[model samples]
Target: MAEWWRGSVTYQVYPRSFQDSNGDGIGDLVGITARLPHLAALGVDAVWLSPIFKSPMADMGYDVSDYTDVDPLFGDLAAFDAMVAQAHALGLKVIIDQVISHSSDQHAFFRESRQSRDNPRADWYVWADANPDGSPPTNWLSVFGGSAWEWDARRRQYYLHNFLPSQPDFNFHNPAVQDWALEVLRFWLERGVDGFRLDTVNYYFHDDQLRSNGPMPTRDNRPPVNPYDLQDHVFSKSRPENTGWLERMRALTDEYPDRTMVGEVGDAAWRNVAIMAEYTQPGRLHMAYSFDMLGPEFTAGHFREKIEGFFAGAPDGWPMWAFSNHDVIRHASRWASHGAPDAVAKLASAMLLSFEGSVCLYQGEEAGQVETEVLFEELTDPPGIRFWPDYKGRDGCRTPMVWDASEHGGFSEVKPWLPVKAPQLARNVAAQDGVPGSVLEFYREMLAFRRMTPALQVGRTRFFDLPEPVLGFARGDGLACVFNLSARPVVLTATGALIDGAPCHAAHLDAGRLLLGANGFAFLRPDGGLGLSAG
Candidate 1:
């Protein structure tokens, strides 16, 4: 199909936890290359490998030390080339994570920028003078916890870091910085890659005035786990200048044949979709995703607003949606209270795949992988360690993939970097292979169905005004999907032909109505044009 990514399904592989071929308790490019067939078997159109770039591992590779080289831990450039070749051979497009919003303080660019102010690269980073009282230049808070500004005595200036202190934010306001960033993108594009999964894409720009973010009034009585949430974060990120950089990125991508860019728009739920809509408009990013659906809220209105709102704001824009990723808690575990873990996974999968945009399936989500429980001592994430019992960090979700019933779940010969627990191990691929009604097989079935269906892919969506617990919507003119979001069974009118998922599966179609079991869902082909009422 033309513009394969328009409605393509992407499988996100967390390389460090996917598979370890060298048996150093870490996954590498060779491991990912070997697993290309697994992704092919899952029927995904693309493979998005989370940062395999050279990094100091400050934020699990989000802190990049070198832009143009592969990390020795993941393997050399040869391994990356082999992985790309294998993915292309398997009919899967390749998307690499671009964490250029910030770089490791040890990076050559940041190192020189941190030197005395007269250096050539001094303005390459977001440096500023401290307040007269010796405080930070601004009250902008870091997502990791404290002030976003980290003071460097060498330059006698404060540097911006929306993330960790070791990962300094780049000065996108500088034309040289933007040019260097474009060259970095060119290096990867010349490597035969298909697209980019831009990490913290909105964090690429900050207010040039170094203004303070206003206080955000909390709607609840209880306080948040981190103080960063106390502020509105307007000045810290989501600056308007980001649009120019996005346009630059999109222009660079257009130079390459069939290349695309999907950015991660991390913002408040009330506005992230609008930001995503804005960024993905015609001359900017080809697609964008937000933390809206990745959060704990799994209501009908929430899903409708995110999917519909994005299109409502930018009709020409596209969205790449997901329920689980390396950064957040696995949706299977996060939404377990709604139904059985497997049921929730299947329901979420159907709902996510049936939407009117591209979809990303995180590693281990197919087998209904739940988040692992990492003890305080086993944690490697900085925020998790700093916050303790309150926030266990992302280590749980980033645990090594479980492939079998053997010890270590066939992920590695030696112990993995993150421990694989019983819950995760129990949902192994070996146990679910070819099993009828198994979560793994169901994923295969859903992916196969999604691939074969036209309306579900690159289609116009109109949501139904059905009541709570029943999320009814039509995709294109022919396909209609209904999902039961609750634990108890419910019945609704069947406005279309019963084609898939009934009786023994997610739901059942009776005489003229549909009876949806706990967390059940169904796909129907409307008899005529889907003229459903507005949601």
Candidate 2:
């Protein structure tokens, strides 16, 4: 039987900003449970909740203090159970963020591991002695700012952390650690989660030799805000040993029926595609996503290359594409320079859904939410505060979901964790619920369209040699997909019969000439293979 996740849409819910049922200025499982209907209406198959596990709130919930328990900030075990039950009732599968690569420094394993050299759990985390000059162990830089190694007085050694110092990387070389991590997965599986989103899946294992990484080759491209991007990072992450662990996880997931796992391969574009291919083989992750499509490039060539490149590298591997998540700027605001915000938003939704693989839609993205402009004092992301004006951090995209035009956008009756600004509030769910031509309505229509179209749902993609501002591809046997990847209008001579799923904007095929307005897209069932000649 085919898995339900193949070519399905999964919605990502950032718990803190989604909704607040208790008016505590924070969103809990109770709040998420109350909003299950929203996902059901959006026609998503699953809900991927960003880390709601026990944490001290450092680095948001990515720093897991207790893997087996829910954070008090979100809710308790009962709340999680109830939420899972409600999601199941609404026909939505629950997929949680499994931060297995690292854990909060406050975790019991880390605490015990850091206590003494010969303690029972001393080998649980990556710890190494300093060099002769009492300096750090390696030249590794943290993703946040400074050194990746933090000196621990208790163990008299420096420990490894890829992100915040408080979130230490585990020692995957230790077999005991692997056993414990698998146990954590089983714990959640028993609680009725349908799947897992493996966070930092590539960072699970490090080069056991602790070798230094080489410098990244210089290019004309824009560099990341942090110095961490300067290194090739071969020694720190994406080790070959990680595949063994993924196989172990797959074995555990296979214990239950209808389970799935999607890995997050964190690396540069060149290596990310290969890693995603490797991690998503039959015995490993069911699917994986890379940061390739998450960057600033918005063009027909860029999208075409990424989609083609992945299939070229791994024909059998599955890929999951997403434009916006908790990590980066929202697509509507990020690509606003190319087209109108609302138009770009709708176009992105249409293009993403039409892609060959599965898809993920971040919460509030259906309403064309743009990244908020956050100020210095109001900043909460570690990297944003560390880098100030240069990098404002992810807080812009992590603002509360606006349900209404009321105070705080009805996300909460009281003040929310993040401020509810005017721009975000103006695009509230209530305002666009039934409004035709609204981004929200467009998303609902497109999702339903994808569900109904067999070709769009599970079709193989074959690209056409269309020039700039125009991308043409054939999906399934007959459906020819074409798009104008610019704010300017374009027209081409092609042979096809127009097919309507979602509304086509300013597009029509008449007398063998296909006219596409600015930001226009169309689907056609041609009499034969699409033959094109642009005027």
Which runs of model 2 end up more than 4 angstroms from their true locations?
220-224, 529-535
TM-score of each candidate structure, all chains considered together: 0.97, 0.98
Q: Pick out the ten consecutive residues of candidate 1 with the lowest summed lDDT.
A: 526-535
Report lDDT (CA) for all predictions.
Answer: 0.88, 0.90
Please give, for residues 255-351, the per-residue lDDT of candidate 1 as tens digits: 9999999999998878787898899888999899768888889898889978888899989999989999998999999999999888888898888
Q: Which candidate is the best by lDDT?
A: 2
lDDT value, candidate 2, whole model? 0.90
Q: How many residue pairs clash in each candidate?
A: 0, 0
Best by TM-score: 2
In model 2, the clashing pairs are none
* Cα-lDDT of candidate 1: 0.88
